[model samples]
Target: MIYTGFMFIVVGIIVLFRKIYLELQNIKIIIKIFKQQFSSTYRNNVQIKKQKHLTDLSNFIPLRSYKVYTIDQTTSLERLYMLIEKAGKTTKFSFSTYHDDESNKNYFVIDFIQPSSSIIINVEISKISHVLNDKLQELLSIIFYSSNTIYTWNYLSFPPVDFLIYDHIYSMNTDKINPKNFISLQHQFKHWYNRTFKHDENCQQIVDFVDSDGPLCSCPYRPCKFPTDTWSLSMAIMYTFHEHLQLNENPLEQCLAITKLAIIIEEGRNRQRIEALRSPSIHT
Candidate 1:
């Protein structure tokens, strides 16, 4: 009976140790999250200052705002430019030929700065609704390699109206349309943002968040699941305004550039996973 009682005590001790270990792991995760958030905010504040400086420079001076990623020889600029062409004629988007000047890197900008009206347009829904699916699929193809993965990591708050509904609205009333009519669609997309972000209301915060660096939607949002595409299309729009029904001129170029950026990010994440596997002491 004494031996059985001693075994029970040993088991209780073992269980207590396991609980402590799990709690410690949880604390570590929380610490890491806070560190990342703080780091991001600091970088954003610096970028905002830089953006103000660049904005006073000139028009057509490619804003230093495109997302940058690390790429080696395998990710050659020539090869990437060719891929952009394969998607569509790269010239349509005014994609400069891949030059190894080292000063200028391969990138595409989507923002339009109207000096007269002082209106800066960042993200816009495509008026051509049919193309939305194809562009999104093309983007997903390079990032995930399969449409199947889209459902697994659903992060994009895509525009609500399909081509048919948009056409119906256009035919019914082109003159005077109320923005309030599309309230339902806005509500539907509220749940699609990353980590319980209130996309509809808080997404407006993105207006001031953009500058020469890139769109900073990190205000209330945790790291977005699809940061490559979603981060580039940082500012969003409701279908209420006529201006909302527009997209970048060379949609394919922007899509292709974002895909390349996605590749760099995934490769980094992949390396981290491999390193974690090698280091058994390192809790992932």
Candidate 2:
């Protein structure tokens, strides 16, 4: 009788394991179905929005032109506004009449990511296409360029503008970055820095300041190293933007970090010098 009872228990255990495996397979099928449905709905919604915006533009555009943008963080907006304000100050022909015209909107695209959403303004560029070139994608690209944000906020194209970027451009706190955001942010930062600041005057000065004993700030530190000309010292602050792995609010500390990067590059050059000196046969 004892042997019979043991045999029964073993059979029950085997049946339970089989049932568990079957249930897990069913769960996997269900999850796959849900993801497929979600993806379909998201694409459909985006298409509808694009169609609606395009329909609205058809009425206003003379040559059947359209413009769109997806903007992010506060700095991106600041850069946008800086251009718009300069346009306003310079008395851009379209700036004054964008709003007064019944059919136009002056400042479009003012969505925010997290903390900066609260401060976004709702101004439009109602008459930009009217006064400026009908094709704004090329011009907006130049004006809205900056390293702080990841994507382009200006498009001189029609709806379903897949090539155009329509995402938020927020400056992460730099201390604690979301892993997904950090990856894209790091990539965009490198691309923009290389393009924009490669020949910037302040960037050159910061390189000099670290090695040549230049002034620490506007006023000389009196005993400074890494010195260079102080023509556009203010731009050195932008170097901090690229130093994402290490960011501090204090501009002075950021300047120091910039100095350190210059130090690393300079050190590399010195090492090459030393190696060349030791090897008479090798022309570096």
Please give the RMSD to the true structure for each candidate, in Å.
23.0, 24.7
What is the C-alpha local distance difference test score of each model? Answer: 0.33, 0.32
* Total backbone collisions, model 1: 2
Q: Report the lDDT tens digits of candidate 1 across residue range 40-71.
A: 99999889976764453221111123332222
Provide TM-scores for the models: 0.20, 0.23
- Tens-place lDDT per residue, model 2, 74-132, is 22544555545433322101100112245442233321212111112233332233223
**Candidate 1 off by > 4 Å:** 53-284
Model 1 TM-score relative to the real fold? 0.20
Which 10-residue window of candidate 2 scores lowest in summed lDDT?
Answer: 91-100
Off by over 4 Å in 2: 61-284
